[model samples]
Target: MTARRSTFTALVTLLTFAGILVAPQASAASLVEVTAFGDNPGGMRMHVYVPDSRPASPAMVVAMHGCGGSGPGFYSGSEFASLADRHGFIVIYPSAQQEAGFGKCFDTWSDAAKRRGGGSDPVSIVSMVTYAQQRYGGDPGRVFATGSSSGGMMTNEMLALYPDVFKAGAAFMGVPFGCFANAADYPPGASRCTGNGGANRTPQQWGDLVRQAYPGYTGTRPRMQLWHGTADTLVPYSLLREEIEQWTDVFGLSQTPTSTDTPRAGWNRSRYGDEVEAYSIQGAGHSLPSSGMAAAALEFFGITGTPDPDPPVPGTCSVKPTVNAWNNGLTASLAITNNGTATINMWSLAFTLASGQTITSGWNATYAPSTGQVTARNAGYNGTIPPGRSVDIGFQATHTGNAAAPSSFVLNSTACSTG
Candidate 1:
């Protein structure tokens, strides 16, 4: 009898601990309807994932849906729930207004949406965020968004129209076609998706409009990521490429890169200044492939990435920056500047060298010649750099027999040219 009672007590104790271990940390899971207040919210329905711990964690993100889709569809298909589970972050999926017409897109770039009186989607988005913070536990400081197709276009529009509302945004296969074009050509000119009383404008027109708006805009441009398939039939590749070029040019980015096919079968990758980047897949089209784009984008959004199996810190790198040389290699000095407000723990730059010449030696960093890469380690020994500080790391190398010194280089993941 004594033995049985002891065994039962032990079993009960173990079970209780196990239950505690498995319990979720969030306070409550709430599904709230964000009323458009009779303003026609584009039929947007909102659902939130709030944790048990209130105010302790950041309510990380809210993702909007594309044309003809709802919040549930985006949440279930995008695998955002799993990300929420892993990161202990809250995610809200919000729907857009739907109309009983041939086209089902939000008039993202419309001038009406820009004004206070118009049934603006940006206002609705801001309202949703405000509601989440007030009623639900949302950390306004860390809010971000990622959208697809029409949702992506809205993401771009929101960045331009409501730049202060979000810290960051990712556009997957979406571009603000009409907003960037000439207002006059757009019919009801500049009224959102349907221009001039609901007429649609072409990509060229959209680009022209954006150019005109660029000079006088006073708001800061938030961080953004643009992902599109090279072969996307739904949104032509040409339009996306033009937008990419236009944005980089507008930003005054100096670096220009030639595309090279990545080892990943159909992938082609190119880099401009640290400000602009693009990836194109030769045979891939329309949608995201299973592999790297999302992960890459997540990194771009400042989200923590998969811990490097072996953190790349504590490594030394080499570079032989130079000018003109018959060997297709020249001696030059490379300077790395920290643009962000915080100190970077570590950073790496990867690029291919001209077929023959190679990097010989780099300072305060290490060089991996075989991979054509450079990695720097400043942990512990190197202190934090004050905001807007610059660090100079140079390299020394001799051009191999009869090879021309390499003229261009990539820094901190951005391409750089001599000119």
Candidate 2:
């Protein structure tokens, strides 16, 4: 009886601790619906959150939702409403329409949606900003925009199409403006988005894309903040590099990062002067990080009194590859290791496939093959690689004659030796 009681007590204690680990944090603000209060040009539903202590002319933020996510969900998930409550700001969550095949995603990839001064989605979002400033006593000059995933892509579109409207914008897990020329090019997963690495375009070439988004615009461009999970398989982590390069060129900042901050073990910030800041959240997946990203964005826009905490020492990670099995010029298995001090949230592996070999199917990653080059991004579950841990991913390929392993392998953009 004594042994049984001790085991039961230990089990109860462990379960309690587990519950604490997974419990959701309480939200600081409540969401309120404002029906038909603004011009519904794009026919979007508005869910606004206004703090009780909102001062006169409070700053307004237009928050957008990702594909298949509603405004309320975004409000709850991003904790934007909570931040608004604390900071005395107004937050507008614009819900998207269910387009024919794309579900609830803003048409940011289309030319019509990217245009300025029209009744399209971009213009409609700007109208929301205008409405917030007019009816909600929002500061027009201090208005900002932010979103995640597809919404993040829309955020980029807004900044480029209406540079004068937004003082600053942040995009999490998004692509650059005009990355896809049209709807047909819009792949089901953004991991396949074009211009992932700027397509080797020069700074001028990339800047020209943004310039063309708004014709004859010479206003001061809005500042930009980009955040990406290092382990995001849905959107390749390499795309973050392209986004920074494109924006830095548009802002005419040097290519090198002006400042690098590791706010904690798994967070990193690379500032390109004051106009552009890119955050790489180590061990984070496709979701918004809980480590004060919303607060940091508010501070960057100067809308909130809270300042970002100084980053701590950055974490390091190393990658190793091992061939698990190769069969009859047809099947193969590979394993990778994270041999570093911190957890890896997102990762990309690149290698040269043996000549005449073609990948047919892969698991635990988004596989892309191009003329002797192959790149695989982390799938949702396999991205988090803890320190001194390992994960296995496998692929099937067809080879003409020889099925030898390639001579080189790179992980997270760093070269690695095969184990």
Candidate 3:
């Protein structure tokens, strides 16, 4: 055991310095291998990492791997085990059976896997968690789960089918639970599986699917964080919108975002109260962000704050608004510029609409219209504005007679000069 620990530490140090390890792969000598079977059908193999100085009941995180990826690959790629070392938690990387189908992916699209009871993939995962808690002294209350791609789809299944087992979950580049009911529904391309688009379903209808997955359990729903790359060709970006709607409906939260911010370049987060949040990674495609996500998910789970040490402060930046193109009194193209030295994490622009005019639809921001008052908050992708950088947000409106632009605008509570 001592020699294995020494070798693991050396491998990690080399990988960190080389900056080449990111993503899940087959097990390494460092991870402790264990098979979970006998009780659960279609059993799984788990590669677990325990920190050196764990508490009596340390937090446990179960991470699932994407198609063609191994538990160790995910463990090394996400550096989740490294996080466990720092945070004193246990990290489990569970592998799907190769017979499960394409690239050894979890059987998330099959009805058998979606069921809550025994013989299903979801229940098999629960069994693994139970083993961790019983054998390794894991805290039952602080269990969390996360995954990417097909594994992410499985993560969705776990959250919906076993909400009582997981306090929170995060899925990257994956669809909502029950998105695809069968293999035939999967897209032909490299894109991940997505079903129905949920376009025809009401919020209540979508929430009903989740409730039916568990059947008669009325415990607190698990919190969720969703991440997707906007430029991914495989999975449509619109799927992220559908997923947000599904979980928010389950939590009974409004569609409108409670807060929006760009924590870094290419990463925009829209938070819905505290129950659900979504991150849109700008210009990224089909993979997890190369850095920071593991720690970020842990921070979301209340495990540690190593990722975001400094909490966000309200911006004091100056905003300048410009009217790019105004349609025949009905539509307008507008742009806002950040003119402050510091990057603005979140921004909101407010202006009173002209009498008898109302906003209909908007882009690059969320528009909330009231009687003579209109507020637009940054959308997921445009929330972070670096110094001197600008983003465009536009809206279409209906007017009875003459259409006129609002005289002034306020951004983040500071008055903005109309350009």
| Per-model TM values vs. the true structure | 0.54, 0.66, 0.65
Task: Score candidate 2 by lDDT.
Answer: 0.73
Deviation (Å) of 374 in candidate 1: 34
Instruction: Give a tens-digit lDDT track for model 2, residues 1-419.
Output: 89997996787789777874322111236676655454566777777777878789899898988888878878756657767877889998888873726568887766678778755688667776776777767898898999988888888889988898999999988888877767766655442464345345566777888898888998899999999988676667777877887899899999899889886445698999989999997655566534357778888888876554732212543334444335545555666776667555546666788888777887876666533777666664465667777777767777777777654666654566566
Kindly report which residue stretches of model 2 are placed more than 4 angstroms away from their true locations once superposed: 1-29, 37-39, 98-102, 189-200, 306-419
* lDDT tens digits by residue: candidate 1, 1-419: 89997996787789777874222222344434444323334445666666554356465676766667777666554545444655556676777664423335555645665443345566676676776666555677777777777677776666655545666677776665344333332222233333222324443454445445434565655566566765455565554565465445545554365333353434465666554456664433444422344445555566656423222212223335444455545543545555555443334334445554566655654444422333332211222333456555555555556443343454433344432
Given candidate 1, what's the lDDT at residue 112?
61
Relative to the unseen true structure, what is the C-alpha lDDT of residue 390 in candidate 3, on a scale of 0 to 100?
A: 79
Q: Taking the tens digit of each residue's C-alpha lDDT, what string does model 3 give over 1-419?
A: 99998998898889879986533322423577665422566567777887776799999999988887788777766657766867789888888874544567777767777778746567677887887888778999999999988777787888998899999998888787877757656543523344234334566766888988988998999999999987665566777887788899999999999999987644799999999999997655565633567678888999986465233323443434333334444666666777767655445566777787777776777665433766666653465667777788877777766577665687745667676
Model 1 lDDT at residue 69 = 70
lDDT of each: 0.52, 0.73, 0.73
In model 3, which regions exceed 4 Å deviation?
1-29, 36-38, 98-101, 187-200, 309-419
| CA shift of 229, model 3, Å | 0.3
Candidate 3: 10-residue stretch with minimal lDDT: 309-318
